[model samples]
Target chain A: MIKPELLVTPTSVENVEEVIDAGADAVMIGEERYGLRLAGEFDRTAVHEAVKLAHERGVKVYVAMNALFHNDTLPELPDYLAFLDKIGADAVVFGDPAVLMNAKQYAPKVELHWNTETTATNWYTANYWGRKGSARAVLARELNMDSVIEIKENAEVAIEVQVHGMTCMFQSKRTLVGNYMEFQGKDLGVEGRSKDRTLVLHDPERDVKYPIWEDWNGTHIMSPKDMCIIDELDELIDAEIDSFKIDGVLKDGAYIRDMTGLYRQAIDQYAAKPEEYIEEKEAWRDRALALQPDNRELDTGFFFKETVY
Target chain B: MRTEVKETAAADKRVITKKPELLAPAGNLEKLKIAVHYGADAVFIGGRDFGLRSNADNFSIQEMEEAVEFADRYGAEIYVTTNIFAHNENMEGLDVYLREIEAAGVRGIIVADPMIIETCKRVAPTLEVHLSTQQSLSNWQAVQFWKDEGLDRVVLAREVGMNEMLEMKRNVDIEIETFIHGAMCISYSGRCTLSNHMTARDSNRGGCCQSCRWDYFLYEDREDANAESGNALFAEEDAPFAMSPKDLNLVQSIPKLVDAGIDSLKVEGRMKSIHYVATVVSVYRKVIDAYCADPDNFTIDPEWLKELEKCANRPTAPAFFENTPGYEEQMFRNHKQKTPFDFSGLVLDYDADTGMVTLQQRNHFRPGDTVEFFGPEIERFSMTVGTIWDDEGNEIDAARHPLQVVTFKTDQPVYVHNMMRKEL
Candidate 1:
């Protein structure tokens, strides 16, 4: 049998059960106001239910409290963390250090998964976080496979790598798209921003076209092409990466099932016939490619190339 | 919903007595000394290795020691920036480098990476650690996180607005610094990879060609078609400064910043000329000192504004401190942002014998043209150029050649790197 190891952000209650059903070893949940995913809809009841469902199925549930907290919100986090701990979350994934600092003080039970929002690129950072009570490190999306292997070799903290989905090219706290819309006199909630009217920009010098949008969190200028590395699951497993992450909290259940199922199948097949992985790699790539949304372009980003200055 | 941050209780009563530090950027040793003379309380600079701003004439061990000595005379501090996110390979020589910086008497090390922060704590525990804005700590909770991590100071992110800053001061028990002036990053604090994807240069590591400021065209590649080709149908299109934020100018926001109890107000131009450093620092220095002297009477001055306007080359906006800037704040994309004055020359040496100044031409200047000469401590002073001549005493109508040292007749004598500019 294939060694089971796949993690996905279940986004909502609508997909939480389905995500677990589709062979995910773990599922991440987030509240709209708390995590980096501003479009998230989970509240206290929803989050409690998600953790219960995942735990019942013998699946680990990690709740994301990954958004950077301002002074005002920092005070509110302790109660939320206590709630997560009360609901029995297996891990709490967060990017901000303040959450960890406060969690250590007020709500100490929730296992902290430090996600530095692409800042933890090296082995030393992994080792550093491991020392600081981080149960896992969701490595930055920018790192190549070589770096990931190096991190795994050096770090005692378990590593989680995003194996599939949309990667942010530019993330800014200033609401660029929101400000631009307000300038046009459109009230955000009243106007109901759609993908049809999404602002598409291309830096002619770089010739890179990207989609820019805003939520409560701020503007996210995303790469035009989404990333999919399910075809390379064997490589991650060989490198001893603990978790293969699917980055789709913003996507729907159909997306959730399709993406999660593809990675599950890929991992299973690769494990069943370790020597046959190379021979069957093309078929795996073809199957994974078919599962992707036809409208969106796809690429194997930053995986093949090292980020050298 | 991310609601607008509310103004907190006025912290004026608690903050007005003790003066906040006026921090300036020193790209070179000369600029470091000039900045302190013009009233910079501290200077942040790059080292020969590991520091960001690879293009700057970063300090060697000797220059850093000399710089520390110079700043000590004025009771100013020197901070070395090793803000680059280090990889495993990059960790070599890091311990040696930290020890070297500490031995050179650097007051602090501004860092973003936890590994580097750990290294600093391990090797140079004596040196203070200031979190670089590159880490993008917009929230006070994040500031507290750095504090717990043993960092002494936290540089607030540019995305942090005025109200948020006040709240940070009220809540976080750490020295808070904010960038008051200079180029704002299009990306969050400094996390970007546009340069990396476009060119081979990784922005996080330092070789930022400022790909955001490149001439661009607004091309709309609609989703309905062009799936394969990625061709765009045109609108009224032009792309210039598409990603360039108008340079931040908070000179007028001195009172609010003072009230917020911000520990330091940083000026952000490391690759700028000594004249730019002198002009910008002195103006901020005057503004900060005026506020400290008479808190209630401190009003934004038109003269100070005029002096600042002549130095900066880009269009200025009160960036995120007030609110998010609109479309008008963006400089033109097809060309560079227009300035009222161009950098005309640099004052080299003054000759009492000839009553003339030897100047190096940066742009171009002619005889009989009025030019403004300003230094670190001095305000704008205009002098009419009588005659211009090259090295061999041959009089030339115009000093056109770049980096050509020429003698020009002047009534007022000036020091080295004192900028002279002609009004356009």
Candidate 2:
């Protein structure tokens, strides 16, 4: 089985070295203006420093600029793309074509990764954008294992899959939290918009609480369970996926480091000796579960589901 | 009212190169015919497979052929939806499905999946590829990306505002379609998975449970030290949270839309009733024609809005058109939509000599109830029901049975497919 690159999202430029030491082959960082629900915002100076530090350690830096850009935001992409290019970022993760257009003109050297959140389900679309210039496609988390393997085999571009962390269940451009407060005739202002407020939505019919928050972009509701695929690493690596992404958005530095270290051990052990790793798979799963937040459950997301719709 | 609109429009004599195409939804073969009869320039329908509206009474290949033929006679085009975000499993028989719809004489296909788009382009070369709004095309460069790839048209995302659309038009030469009226998804189309996560229904694959409209109790994280110590702070009684957006209504913006050279104006609802399809399509049709006839002197008829209210389930607003919507655009307290009228019946036939109008009953309507009769060709007029005869010619006081064939006397003539509705 080929070893897949373990991609971990870092909380800051200062956190880059820590995650790399924890065994990250690549680090993804972005500014809040362009990225949606990023772990932390890195300014232009920080981006340059992060790239230099990651490259020195034989690691790659992927910049996140994947917001659905409106007319007001599209014009700012050119300069940002140029800066990423100047700093030699490995790729610019994007969902909007405006980013692709601006990158082509301003930073032709930077690689493009098609990550349209939910639309990149099959290989043909991946290849479609691959033909246009995307170097990789992030498969939608809604896909099952069979679909992922099929896409990995057929797509001309590299395939990246999210193997850990909270999954966004819904994102709306409307400031739902702020609107609720206003509708209530209460002005919580900063408290209402702050992501640190730890807001959640509880459906009365179900005994689950979905984490909800508001940021500069809009409202985001997260799933009740964090996707922990420690045991499934062997399957993805055996399938020869290009990259294994561990999203650290809304997570603490300790969580990112622990997850990166565990996934790294699993991926390495599996590659080194598949039989030995198989024997110890349950132990690895337990260790990962022990690290998970008490409030959040852990599941394989849609990977093991027999059916989705 | 028609004469009055023309009189107001006569003052402005500017000519547009083309009047925008009026697109409507067709949940079934009947809705297809009704939309065309009511003046839809194009009608989008979902075939039995690979569309996002699985619950709709979608068309089969045979029915699609019939719909295409009927629409052709009226010079209206038919576009079938193969717009599901397809998985590898959904890819089976898709090439054959594309060819089948093409052979059925579908003018185009609405698709979001790249495989479907590429397959349609390869196997069904004759069918135009209209990118579904599920892609959330908010900028011109994205439109240009598809245009460069050889797709024919792009349906602007509901979140794309008017200024953004105009910018896109200035930048791209491809056909542009905008949703003039419909229910708005609070999240960007195809970006939401609340339904998939909440109810095991893949909204991208068309089994949407609409979990965003579900009532929920809001609370701060209980694990936080500052979290309210008791249920008093985050109880369901503190007003349940809902993110359901009001429906989009752009009737008043018809002149601007026409003047902007938008290629098509679409109404969104495949699962809507026949009455809804007719009323919405006809109102847009009337407003578009009036504005295009005289751009400068055009004014929206208040009656058109009133007619829309009869079928409106949710309150309507011009969402994301003029500006980013605010608190007013969402319904947080309650999600259920209410309409002021009930669709009473559909006209089956009219005997002019005997002054008899036969109706197919939909909802309960009794004798002495005043109902309005409106058709594609006739002016709307109210008639007081006097005496009714059942299919057997027995006089009945009320037409309570669904789809019951009943007859009434009216001096005015009516045609088949004409609708009757009563105030609720």
Candidate 3:
């Protein structure tokens, strides 16, 4: 069986190299103008360079063009896809059907990873996109372990699952933060809109703080807890899952490398000797906990817990 | 490159020259009839399973057949929503249900998941498959993608603007449906899982808890030392942070939309009252007709906005239609809507000779309360609540019980399903 590839969302081209060195099998990079909620973006030249750098080490690179495009931005997508194809991007992660359509027209060689964020919940939908030429389906983070296993068992395409990251709970096209600041008769400068500002929404009733930020796309409210599945990697590896994705969009370059390294080590150990990996999970959890941000908490997030109405 | 695709498509389909269908939501059979009576060209209903509005009183298969039969009488169409992003468990009995709705004469099925779409195409080939707005389709290529996949129509996302719709109409050959009036999702419709994370209710699978409307305090995530220092942004003294958006109202833009030849104009809210369905459907019906009948001299009526405001549960703005909504389009202090009008009663019967109209009381009403009566065909008229009579013909001063049969004298002739509202 093929070992599950570790996919890391890189914070920069240099970070892409750092993660590859730390044992990431693949890295995802994008430009802020096209991608949604990226940690950092690369220019056209940087993206070209990143692909070349990753390919040198036999690491694959996926470009994110997952924004919900309006007609105004859509005409430019074919050119963008052609550019990604020309630069030999291994795949293009997409949430909108238009991205797949444009890629089919202009970038047929580049693979398609259907990541609608929350809609790819079942195997039938995954296979449906697969038949339409998508090479992989990123199942929704809302699914539990049972659902994920079921999808992977029945899916015709490759499956990628989020193993560790901050999950986005809410995304809007309206500038909600800007709208609120304007309502309060205050000015929210560029600094206020930056994701590095450590903005969070506190639900006083629940006593939880959710990280919130605004970008060119709109407002994004993240979950209060990040997801860590180091201990759970065995079930996925045993299931022969195609890929494990680590979202470094909200973390630093060091966090990305360390998390990637820990997961890489665990995956290898679990794939090689399941009993030995099981004995080492407690220490793995502690190591992961130590790397978590001071204001953020970590949990297993919808993987073990069945979501109920 | 884009214009070349447009020219080739324009030569084949003159989609924009036709009259747009006015679609409305119906939670049950009663609301379905009310929507059709109020002049909806098409009505979308939900069955007992697979629809997003599970909390609503969705229809059974028998009720769906009856709804289709009833809608057909008025030359209107019935579309069923099987639009849930299906989990594996939800996939059971989906094929059977799609075939049943098709056999019951449903004109189409609005679907979000490809499982449902593929199932409908395989088992119920006669039914038109519409891609739901839950897919958040905002561009022509997405429309073209679904069109090639054998779907008939695509409901554009609430975030799409007028120019985008026009561009889609010019470029794509499939029918385009746009939301004109309704509560807008703060997040893109299907992309949000705030409810799933916050309350353990899956938003994509018909279990939305509306966590976006819940109260939350805003703050910056500073270090533990500074966390308690109150670095809250976008908050007044004690107001809860509100993410609930203003409802979409496109009454003023009816002429532009009709002129643009958009295929269907939809109103969102299956869980709303029959009175809301009647009022909103009728207002849009009138506006669309008035504009289409004489496009050169069409003007928006101020009374239409007043009628819509009477039933709206939130402040209304032209969200993503004329412009990108901003401060005036959101409610930041409180998420709740405040309106003075209460839907007081529904007309059951009208007798011209005795000057008596029977009403099933919906809200509390007593003698001397000023009330307004309106219906699908009835123009708005105000009257003072006079002497009331119970079903037993005994004299009564008030109709205190809910849905209790009450009779009142009205010199003006009223019809069935006419509604009565009183200002509070």
Off by over 4 Å in 2: B1-12, B15-17, B224-236
Q: Mark the 10 consecutive residues where model 1 chain B has the least summed lDDT.
A: B1-10
DockQ of 3: 0.72
Docking class of 1: acceptable
Clashes of 2: 0
lDDT of 3 by residue, A1-309 (tens): 469999999899889988998999998889877887786788889899999999999999999888888878887898999999999999999988888888988998999999888888999999999998899999889899999999999999999999999888888988876676677767677437668887777887678888888887788988888899998888888788899999987789999999999999988888788899999999889989998877777899899988864
Native contact fraction (fnat) of model 3: 0.86
Q: DockQ: which candidate is best?
A: 3
Candidate 1, B330-393: lDDT as tens digits: 5554324456777888777887777788888888889778888887634568888887889888
Q: Fraction of true contacts kept, per model? A: 0.50, 0.71, 0.86
For every prediction, compared with the true complex, DockQ reads 0.45, 0.65, 0.72
Q: What TM-score does structure 3 among the candidates reach?
A: 0.96
lDDT of 2: 0.86
lDDT of model 3 at position A150: 95
TM-score of 1: 0.90
List the RMSD of every prediction in angstroms: 4.5, 3.1, 3.6
